[model samples]
Target: MRIRAKQLAFAATAAVALLAVSLPASADVSGRAVKIGVMYPLTGKGATWGKHAQIGIRLAVEEVNAAGGIGGVPIKLVEYDYQAKESEGITIINKLATRDNVLAVLGPCFSSVCEVIFPLLERLQTPVISYCSAKPGLSKLSDWAFRNSLTSDKQLAPVVSRWAKDYSIKKVVIIHDLEDAVSKAEGSKVLPMLFKREGIEVLDILTFRTEDTDYSAQITKIKSLNPDGVGLGSCYQNAAGIIKEARRQGLSQPFVGGACTGAPALIELGGKATEGTYVSTAAWMDDPADAIQAFVGKIKARNGNKAFPYSAPRGYDSLLITANCMNDNGITNEKGDLASDREKIKKCWANVKNYPGVSGSTTMNEVGDGAGGNRVLKVVDGKYVDISG
Candidate 1:
């Protein structure tokens, strides 16, 4: 049942009970709906994440419109494909802020892109909430900048500590991507510190690039150390490859992943190798709570009965929080001005507290900018199950 993200995203055109928001379908007030731009890598190597994000955003749009259309003003999504390139992000944000004049922006899902766009926030005053960026200092770069997903430290620290205490893990090894900010911060700094606090010995640390296809050297080191646990800070594909290689190299110690690696693709790619591995993330797709299940059901029905992607929850939550901020601040189409009301929405997002969603509750923090709930997930028989305490 291996499924590509684009397939998971667009297989079923089965219309949701609610309507999908697109570009200015009927115009809200005066020949234009309140525009919110969505930027993602819809056509490149990382298009999978973009597609997953699109489905989640579309579901949120449907939910928002069903609930009387974001303060009686129907929202329109201005979607763009930056193909996961940071340079493209600069161009897209410039266009989204200056030309499209969208009130707020969502996505540009990579932290690499976030770093490039952080400077644009002060120049444009447009609030941006990233669904996948987990680097710690991103939100602090600007008052208008925010994040919907939990940073690596927030998502992984407690869960890893709990797992170590419960499993009596005394020694660990970390394999990380040196070229990535999120990966470096989590693997080289946060996870090690958390392990140290738990009295776990870090035997060694290893590095790889995002583009490396062969992990034989790293796998050999992991096999040699054979610590009580193996920690990973990597993209889904890289994590899967590493897990497969580690298993092939006879490294049987349990593996734990940071926030970004918690996705269906991990198991889909690693198969039996990923079984029994655990990862921590902001959203728990296997949650049984009514709100979580209902949201999952909608996505399944719309995606031809396939399992939901991890990114969907954050994308859906991002929209809900953004709309709630608008409602809380009373920033509406009453003034019939998108640019003027953008500042008010930004202010509201800065002050948002206890904003709940199917993914996790989020709050605008002063230091890290934004953070949310977290869960530790273990892979059993090729499926991710909530195992956090």
Candidate 2:
């Protein structure tokens, strides 16, 4: 009897030891905090995008931490200002991945910055979700890179079709930013392709550098063409300047622009001149959905009633998506499991589908760009009205 009891005791001890060995090395929330990296061009020309993104990300982090964080571990954001410089972006990304040891990163907002940063993701082995880098197919540079924002091509296709039909635009003069990657692509590639599909003739293609403040020469040339409409491949600031110049030049052609011109800044800067201009956006600020209304209300309250840009919602969604991945994928935030945890987050990000967000339903396509509904907005009385029906 005594020998049998000893053997049973030994077996029980062995079973417990094996269980301990098989278990994960850390508890469910082992780390002091779950670190995530934020990279944005906070001080350069792209400061507007970075500011709005910061608001959204801050709100998301606050909400997550308020709700007991990810499995009771608070999220800590390691932030860096890339200043819209490719070299700065590259350095920031490396530091985020190695020095900070963050599980994932958000932003590096401009496509120019993202173009340089994304190619390094494979070697860094960190996942990055861009909030507003809308240059098409940029995310394809690395499997570790993902975008929560739609590319300019996707956002503009429907809007261009609608703009053509509504304005009876049989011909268009394409004006795009020469130096910016996204603006160049939108004007050179996306607009041409889309216009061709819509049976619109490209009357002329004009270009200007992003730093050019005076667009009178381009506007004069566009006026001479007298096309039925003008297609703009430019950001909000430049697009507004171009449109204002066209108006001043007495060019009455309806103007339509790509994703980058959809921000409130376009209307604010262009004012009455922006009226009747059409642009495509990933998010509609006037959405009647309860969640959207609440988000807008909070943003307005926080931003002193300034118009909220689409980057806000995209940034908010990016963080929430990252948090969801960390929670659902058994992330322990442990020092030893950092590599595996990052991989898990990357896999989760790739499979993101139909996530209902304030920015509409978000699904990460095979190319790593977001797939979601877009809003074709027309500037009316100083407001962007959704005419995408």
Candidate 3:
């Protein structure tokens, strides 16, 4: 989730116009719908998790609306699909800030997309709550940018340390996607750094691009080296392909994946081959806890009993959190001033104490990133069994 951005100054004027519309003199609690825009890659390569996030956002807004909304104002969710494209995300952000003019935005879940849009939000003055994007330094891009999901550091530390210690693993091979921000951070930076800290040897590092389906060449290379373990920093499908190919090529060492592979699709795509794979992730939808079970039941029921991606619950929690923050920080639908209301929302998010959400109790640090821990789940017979100590 650590996407770098190209310069995007051309759209600055539109952000100014959007901000201008919401600058009024006073706050009034009008019984109006508190409109918030929801953006995600509803249709694309990673659309499975993106759609899951969309469903989670929809479920949350529907539930809140049925409960008579926040402080009597209906919480309306406006949906948009960026198709996992940064350009598309920028366009949608502009629309949400100007034409739709929503009070807040719930995200494009990829940090690459966020990197492109976050800078624009500092002036647009609309807060964006990304449920799954976990770029470590992204929150500093704007005061309005917030994440409810775990960062790569928080999400991968436990997985690396546990596997390294428990397995007494020395040399490891890392296969990750170079083009994706999330994979690059985990595969290239975070995991290697952790390995060095633990005095583990990084046998070899390999790279692939997003949308690359075949990993036979990389697997063949891995089979030759015969490392004790392998780590994947790619998204679920890519990770699945790597794991499947590695197993087929007779490399039986256990596999570990960064949080990007935590979605249900990994299990589905890799089947029996995924059984021993360890993943460090945030969402625990299958946790036996009653609260998680209830939330999972609600979403599964809505989506025809199909399992929603792990991202779904995090997205759900982010929206509810922002809404609750707005209400708690004196953000009235009556605040005719968009500027003042945005400031209050930003401050509330920055100073958020312990927000008990499905992702864990999140507290924002001074840098605006959430404070949370990772759960290491090893796939056992198609289920993610927690093995964290």
Candidate 4:
């Protein structure tokens, strides 16, 4: 009888051990930090642009963490530098999706890079929030791709049309760089057509190569036409140079365009020449909203009152919207489970409407583009001031 009792106790102990081994470890699965994948052009032409975005991302992370984190688990941000390469951007997105298993990705400022990697994101059905690509065709890219960045057509065309119609600016010169993807794809064609529709006459249109820095020959030709206004589809660096040279050569006749004209670098390079320059974008830092003002204050304090660049708000708004979507959807920290949880986040994204962000109330449309209003800023006294109506 004693031996039989001992055998029964041993059997019971073995069963308990087996049960414990079969259960998943609670600590490993729960209370782990959620991981978010970030890809950006951290080098090459987009280095400064990526740095500004990272700042906004960090601000968003800080705000989320302060609010008890998502589902009581803190977020861990994983980043990769795409280096202005389309292939690199695609590779990073794929790695984040399949290997690192990020919940979502936000990055790639240039349209060319985003355009290349978008198909993969569609195949994986991963939610992506791009900051500054602003390509019009992105609306039809996929249901999974979301643009926190402003679409160029929606943001700039209306403002240009209104200004042209109001000023009765009949003869206009549209100058664009041939090699610029955004310029070639959108600016070169759309702006001219929009102007024509507004009853403005397109005076002799000219093309400049992005590689060529000298604008004297082009400026002289534009001056010969005596155009009422000049529309430039230039990068910020080139835009400033053009403005500076145009002013020096007395060719300025209410120049505008280049969505980045409001950038601090433009003001820095162009000096007084950037004054009265008009450009439209997703949102300006000088927004009237309390949250936006507070964010601007933070940036100002950090930068020691040096003006925050135009691209800074793009990053700030992207990260803010991402966190807002995650929090609204009841997503918690699931660092190791991002791949499985991506669908849940995508479903949550559909319901995210009019979420107040630093940029504005970003109301995500059916196309996954943030259909927010655009603000037209005039460079006044080296600062961006919103134009009336």
List the candidates' TM-scores in order: 0.87, 0.92, 0.89, 0.84
| Candidate that scores best on lDDT | 2
Give one digit per residue, the lDDT tens place, for model 2 in 47-84.
77788899989888887777567767778999999887
Candidate 1 accuracy as lDDT: 0.74
What is the lDDT of every predicted structure here?
A: 0.74, 0.84, 0.76, 0.67
The runs of at least 3 residues in candidate 4 whose Cα sits more than 4 Å from the true structure, single-residue gaps closed, are: 1-31, 165-167, 328-337
- Report the lDDT tens digits of candidate 4 across residue range 1-389: 11111111112112223222322212233456767788877776536567677776776676656655554556688998898777798889899887877778887777777788877776876888787777677646777787776677777776687567545688888888776566655457777777778778888778877567899988888888998888877667778878888888897687677554445667777789888777776766766666667777766765667665545676766665555445444454456456556766666555556554566556667777767788776778987777847
Instruction: For candidate 3, write residues 70-102 as lDDT tens digits.
Output: 555677888898998888999999999888878
Question: What's the ranking of the predictions by TM-score, best on top?
Answer: 2, 3, 1, 4
How accurate locally is residue 387 in candidate 3, as Cα lDDT from 0 to 100? 93
- lDDT of model 4 at position 217: 88
Instruction: Assess the local accuracy of residue 195 in candidate 1 as a C-alpha lDDT between 0 and 100.
Output: 89
TM-score of 3: 0.89
Clashes of each: 0, 0, 3, 0
Compared with the true structure, the alpha-carbon lDDT of candidate 2 equals 0.84
The list of candidate 1 runs beyond 4 A from truth reads: 1-30, 43-47, 327-336
Cα error, residue 253 of model 1, in Å, equals 1.3
Clashing residue pairs in candidate 2 are none
